[model samples]
Target: MKFTKLTSSVLAGATLLSIMAPTASFAATSKAGSADAKTNDNGGTKLPQNDHTEVGISFGDNNSNGNTGYLRLQAVPHTLDFGNHKLLDDSKLDFTADGKNTSLSVNNTKGSFNGTNANQTTTLATGTDTALDTVKGTAWATVVDKQVTRIDPMNGPEDTSDPTNPKPTSGFHKGTDSVAGTWTLSVQATSPLTAVDNGDPSKEIVDENGAKEEIKDAKLTFSDTQYAQTQNVLGLTKDKNDNTYAKDLADLTKQPTVAPVKEITKNVSTPLVANGSDITVAKAAAGEGQGANVFGWLPENIKLTMPAGAAVSNAIYKANLTWTLNSTVA
Candidate 1:
């Protein structure tokens, strides 16, 4: 059960235009599963589609001298539309990920293990286990509304027709379809390494009552050159009916591109705030920084897959994506 609401605001924020529309609450959106890649009866995709935008982000500082200065640029919508897309699951994505992050600090210059003071004191960082760390999150996507309309490649450019109106039982037919892509992603702690901040790390973890606890700038690291997962898609139908009432009206209305496809991948390197919402962009804007961000000019990992169908069809089937990250999330 899907719904469609065409709003002017959503069109303004293409990141690729920056528009504003209050955030939509995710009261009960289903979590991503194997359905992350699926098709529908009409060949339409199920994935949410939208544009992107860039906004100033403040992720604290990186220097140890209390001169913090690390920025973050939020990507609006975080979704894409294939116009007329399809997702053939059961196909595998050659996905892979690898990255490292640090979050430990010390301050025991007065002379303690590592560093455990409140001032900018120099102290040795002792070795600690990296398994004591962990992070939890998910990553999945899907497409919806495969074919918008079946076209009859026989009309001229000047043909007069109200595309959005009720149509007649004419023999000729032609139209556009909607292909979409969407995902639900998350990240979690999964490391045995502790930020042996030997120093007093409590200041970084502010308490609800303004009190502070020591949480070293330690980090959790992981490296998986491959994040491959197979998708089992459904919703493709076989609706090839000819009602042209003629000896051979096959030329009257051309058939739509009902090609059955599989495998599509998007390589993305996104940093998830340990306990922050992965917000979506509502629109895009035209500006110097509209397309680029602090992370880089584009998504750290953004690649879409093009699956191969029948074996005798000679189409190839393969997905290869890699990503990495280095950030702080408490």
Candidate 2:
């Protein structure tokens, strides 16, 4: 019975070994299949998956946008009116006036009366009618208001009118991006003062002998010149005492400030000569005078002077003036 039992135990052990061997072989085959799958995935071919798009832009003159990258002269005076006067005598008469008032009048005449009859009382009339042996005259000039600008091509224009955009303030802040360069404002008289007959627009005023009358030595003076920025980049501030001052906030030595419009002939009487050299009224040097600037003279400071002898007839004398703006990098 012991031998039979031993033999049966051995057979059971053999059956268990056969089952374990089959299970081990199946596990090894499954692992190999998994390895092959991983290898195939890593080596799988890939096709290119790329795409493309495009972008574009354009520029133009749009007034609402507040033209940027430009140095511009925005405003100027249109007329300098020298009021009416009388030629009572042949003595040299000087007529000084402004955009509003006049220095010489019927009662306030300047210079000595060189008439042969010193005691002769002459009736001074204030109308367009030509009195006996008396002359009524008016002097005026047509001034052209030139608006000039220089644009930079390197940068796109900015819309300064937008509230969200940065602007030049009163304090010492970083300067706004602009077309940085040099510029000048100049004036010239294109023609001499010529007297025209009031009765006929096409005819010139002539003397008793029909000689064409002209004022060759006529002069126009501009003073108290001032400048302003359209954007109000630099503004005025009042102190405790109510004294006004320029609000300039720049450490001039370090970074360039938006330069103030400088009057080259400030407080000086600049002559307006016909067909003469250009007179620079205001100027901005390199790294200065950015944005829109305007140059103007005080009404009280604008004066026109002419010799009394030039008032030969009862007529209106007219002249032409041209303003110029120049922009440069140097």
User: After TM-score superposition, what is the CA distance of residue 45 in candidate 2 from its true location, in Å?
Assistant: 74
- Please write out the lDDT profile of model 1 over residues 212-303, one tens digit for every residue: 33222222112221121111111111012212212122342453232221221122232222332222211111111111121111111222
lDDT of each: 0.22, 0.44
TM-score of 2: 0.46
Top candidate, metric lDDT: 2
Give TM-scores for every candidate, taking all chains together and pairing residue i with residue i: 0.18, 0.46
lDDT of 2 by residue, 1-330 (tens): 999999999999999988888433332234334345454432433323357887855221111212222333333444444554445234434443432224334533322122122211111111332221111111111111111222123334444786788554423223323334456777778766777766554466778898765677767777655444422222211112111111222312233344544545564343445676677776665555443344445444556666555545656666667776676433
Q: After superposition, how far is residue 232 of candidate 2 from its true place, in Å?
A: 4.8
The prediction achieving the highest TM-score against the true structure is 2
The regions of model 2 sitting more than 4 angstroms off are: 1-69, 88-92, 96-103, 107-178, 199-212, 230-257, 267-273
